[model samples]
Target: MSIGRTDLNLLKVFEAVYEEHNLLLAGKRLHLTQSAVSHALRRLRELVGDELFMRTGKGMVPTGRATAMAPALRDALRRIEDSLGVEPFSPDSSRRRFVIAANDHVTAVIVAPLSRDLQQAAPGIDLVIRPSTRLDLAEQIDLGRIDLAIGIFSQIPPRLNSRTLMSQGESILMRKGHPAARRKLTLRDLTKYPLVTLSVGGQEEGAVGGFIVERGLARQSEMFDRRALEEALRESKQEPRSRVTVPHSLAIPALLRDTQMLAIVPASLAVALAKSGDLVRRAPPYKAGTETLRAVWHGRDAHDAGHAWLLERVAAAARAAEEALG
Candidate 1:
């Protein structure tokens, strides 16, 4: 179907219906009467040559065809809206909520400061922090469900625009007054203690494990393999040493305090904890893989004023974090 011939309003009705899953709620969201919504749906059904949606006990359920077209329709509307500049960007006036995908590690290391700056600079802006995962990032951005994604993404889709925010390595952390804190940590010292490692983006072995392998202190292994190592260490030693696994980098400090455990975490996190005097940070004995945190968005948002504002703020925040760590 030709783009110009299609009724754009129909897509809006479809999107509201799909999201609300109830014609009444969808009509309310669109500021339309139930009859008007039904008329729009009927037109859409005729154009698409399908029922589009069916009334169910749960709500209005989209047909498979309608579900498939939703993302593209959403993208089309977003592109048109952005091109027309329908919503003029005024940080102080615009009260639009932006959803950002990032993990707690990124939040602890960066967003705290970024959010503070945003509050002072753009009081009308609302921000939602969502979990950062590899699933559907590009698709979500395209559909305008997520405005930006920050952190290390293993893969980048061709249609997205991205800029590297910062590069970092990992560090080893131990609690104050712990036996391992008295001496510079070697691989043997690390192996002797139970470990608490941060798992970011499913990478558990992380930089310290890579560094250990690079230094010939240990063999290269996956995070699962490292977990096995921890299990063997626990079973082989007469005294049971405890090993704990956590997801966020910020949690490492609390986990290490008054415990004989050590953690490998992002350098930014380690530095933050060290400045607080709650933990001591040391370099890993071997070379671990480095990570490049990047800010990514859809190409359609490349020239959007609000999106541009967000990018500038994020880049500024990244620089501030790097300088503070330095």
Candidate 2:
């Protein structure tokens, strides 16, 4: 195949299809229709004189030639991007769209402030946040779909890079007039009140240490330190009586209002939620261990100018959050 004859644009569709393993999904990521994506693939195959992928019951399976070509092709794309993107980003003028992943709590605590900052500094920049707790979050990052993920990630794969935003312990959030909101939270309060905790996935869902290892991606499933909370109760010769479980921190606010349920949540989330004035936060008696909120991204964007600027903004927002609740 002649290098001069190849259309570089087709490489993008190839990369997308290779990552997603499905034509429709690849099209969705590229903002192209299914027929367009298929047409591009057909053209690329004809140009290369090989059928790059095969349709299988499982998904689009790459042929041997395509598999062999992936590494160098990806590196070439990265090199091209780096060369073209090294210029300093002008936030005021750039209309860059960054896709970030975070749980609802971090979205509320971090992304929300970051969005406000961007509005003032870079009016044209847009932020798209996906749930970091999703099982496909790691895959999304691997595929370059998610530019950054901000959340408590216990385990990260080698291909990805991470920067810690803040370290926080657990705080109990309850309605302002709840029976225990008037005073400090005791382990007894944990045992007495029907506790509500966040669990995105669990042992039943093939998760270990609150993380589910799926297709080279270990994502957070259970949101809280359930083991520590349960162990504290067992050490006291008491059995846990967790009455409720919710998938997100945001859900607790509405559930706690006019109720006696207590939620063990990140201190930052508690502080942020307390701003509504309906919730009161207090330190939990048992050690919940420190959870680190981090910004994770694919190594491919390590030096991309726009990505770097967004990261700077994320770090600043984290610092601001820490100060607000410090």
- Highest TM-score model number: 2
Q: Which residue pairs of candidate 2 clash?
A: 201-221
lDDT of 2 at 88: 62
**Per-residue lDDT of 192-216 in model 2, one digit per residue for the tens?**
7888888887777788878788666
- Any idea what lDDT model 1 has? 0.72
Check candidate 1 and list the clashing pairs.
Answer: 211-286, 211-287
Give lDDT: candidate 1, residue 69: 83
TM-score of each: 0.71, 0.81
Off by over 4 Å in 2: 7-75, 84-88, 215-217
lDDT of 1 by residue, 1-326 (tens): 55578888999899888766799877876779999999999998998899999999999988989878877776777788877878678887666567788877778777878889888889877787887643444555665667888876545666777889987777778888888777677656666788776554333443454322211112112222344334544564533233887766667777887888878777777787788887888876555656677887777667778889988888888887777766
**lDDT score for candidate 2 against the true structure:** 0.82
